[model samples]
Target: MFLKRITLLRENIPSMKKYPFYIPSIQNLEEIDINNKVTFFVGENGSGKSTLLEAIADKCGFNTAGGGRNNFYDVHAAESSLGNYIRLSWLPKVTNGFFLRAESFYHFASHIDTVGAAHAYGGRSLHEQSHGESFLSLFLNRFKGKAIYLLDEPEAALSPARQLTFLKIIHDLASEGDAQFIIATHSPILLGYPNADILSFDDGQISKIDYEMTDHYQITKYFLQQREKFLDELLNDE
Candidate 1:
């Protein structure tokens, strides 16, 4: 793996009662070892998975707003709050990589159009494509070489079928040993990648979890198998 581990610098923090530090998982974080080329970060909203991912992106010199080294642009409130408090350990560090934040992708697309770099993303403006198409276009065309990719909630725009397509893309990139991916996602499909490491940010801690053990897997499975019963329980007031 390119990024071997991430160490949280608790000593550098000015206060543990602050914004990022107050988040349970991050508050308790010590260190995380990245043991696979494809590592998935799974957690509930506000659980600090994305916060930590953004920090890694910041440390990697990528635009925390969402982009690779050369794609620089400004987005308000895009700065990573926790970035300064973590250290990444890379084995034979790589400079080539991309950080994709779904929320700020529109701004990245606008910047690409302004810079006339649409050719790299399928020869058409990303804005012209549907949201899912645009995401896939970037994944299919711009990802290559020995690089690390940090993606936050990539499944937001993808349909279930498209999500399967993304799995193939990830497999192709990772199998060749030229690319490593650290993705924060809620998609149970993406979490099923063979031999990938799944980290759960739950119960105020970060720990490894099995695929079937994930709530995403169990819930999705149960819902599919017992949709009526599941909805009855969920919708029942009593």
Candidate 2:
């Protein structure tokens, strides 16, 4: 628990009508107290989960595009709009961390290759490996010791089994008390980590909710359990 809380600097904002700030959950956000080693941000698209995560990464001096403090490269429109308007309160600050943006991971891999830094990530080029394999390799090799990892939609490249594998990796890192993770994800499997804090960006606010209350969990459970009836209702025209 390096980062103890995230407080929105409402009084410093120049406009309420702007993007990011206008997003309902961010607009209403006062402060988010991070009490768990792993915190999961759960929300629908455009619900402001990723937005806040990106801001925190930016604030941490990690490239908002993706990568750690030293991994610098360019990608269009990669800056965080909300980063400047938020303050992160750290109990014992840590400078070592990584920010992973799923959509721009290819570019990050490219940056690694250009810098000849593949030795740190499993001693093989990320581009040479499958997407899921590269993700796992990065987790296994590079993640270590007193750091915060901010990941956005890591499930993009992972299969169900791979997600389970990722969860085990998370458990190993977190249980050691050496890493903190704040992940923005739509994966029920990832959200099911025992005793993790799940913050929902729904109903125009950010609030802690039980894992079972998430739409991801409820909907996935329903669809799997009642596929025929679920499809019947969906395909039916009222």
Candidate 3:
């Protein structure tokens, strides 16, 4: 399955407006050659990246709590009258995909345990594992080949090393043409996937960017470059 194009129409509802909610208006979205590959969505907090992902998953017919579902809206809908709107012009002509949200892993594990293979988790509940470990185990165990996956902020729970491991897993899936991944992440390591498209959502617009050109990479670079100066300033303060 391939995604051809994706477009957003509206976002960021204002308070005091008749309806104050941040809902996206998306259109003309399509995926191409996505049978086995990865697409990276990069942005800072509150930049509409996760919202777009959730919308896409919803259009793809994944259960709302599963990888493609968006429960964020449910919690915020009462507070914000604005609702999400999406248009998926094209998708993989196949089925069997997931929409995974990093923040909802605990809920996902619980749901999975009830109906799916409870013993596959080695008797260790998702709550028992460290966040990074749990993510790794889930990807390795649950992800089957020939599937499409949408991930929101997967880097949230992963350490840098674990992000690297996630990259390898993605590579393996893509190489086999068994999976396609659309991921929203802040980790430069995960963004380094070769040939993956990096779309940035900032200042109310989205555009393609190079891996090295991302704010995450540049900010991390600056901090590492001036670590000594930063440390000296801190140590000398008082």
TM-score of 2: 0.98
Candidate 1 residue spans exceeding 4 A from truth: none
* Candidate 3 lDDT by residue in tens digits, 1-238: 4665654334432332342123221222222222226788887787767767776676677655544332232322222121243345445564667777776667777765555555665556776788888888778876777777888888888888888888888988877756878898888788888999887776555667788999988978877999988778879988
User: Could you give candidate 2's per-residue lDDT for residues 1-238 as a string of tens digits?
Assistant: 7999999999999998999899999999999999999999999999999999999999999999999999989999999999999999998999999998999999999999999999999899999999999999888987888999999999999999999999999999998847999999999999999999999999999999999999999999999999999999999959
State the lDDT of candidate 1 residue by residue for 16-48, as single tens digits.
Answer: 999999999999999999989999999999999
Candidate 3: regions farther than 4 A off: 7-36, 68-84, 120-124, 230-238
TM-score of each: 0.98, 0.98, 0.77
On the 0 to 100 scale, the lDDT of residue 233 in model 1 is: 96
On the 0 to 100 scale, the lDDT of residue 221 in model 2 is 100
The C-alpha lDDT values of all candidates are 0.94, 0.95, 0.66
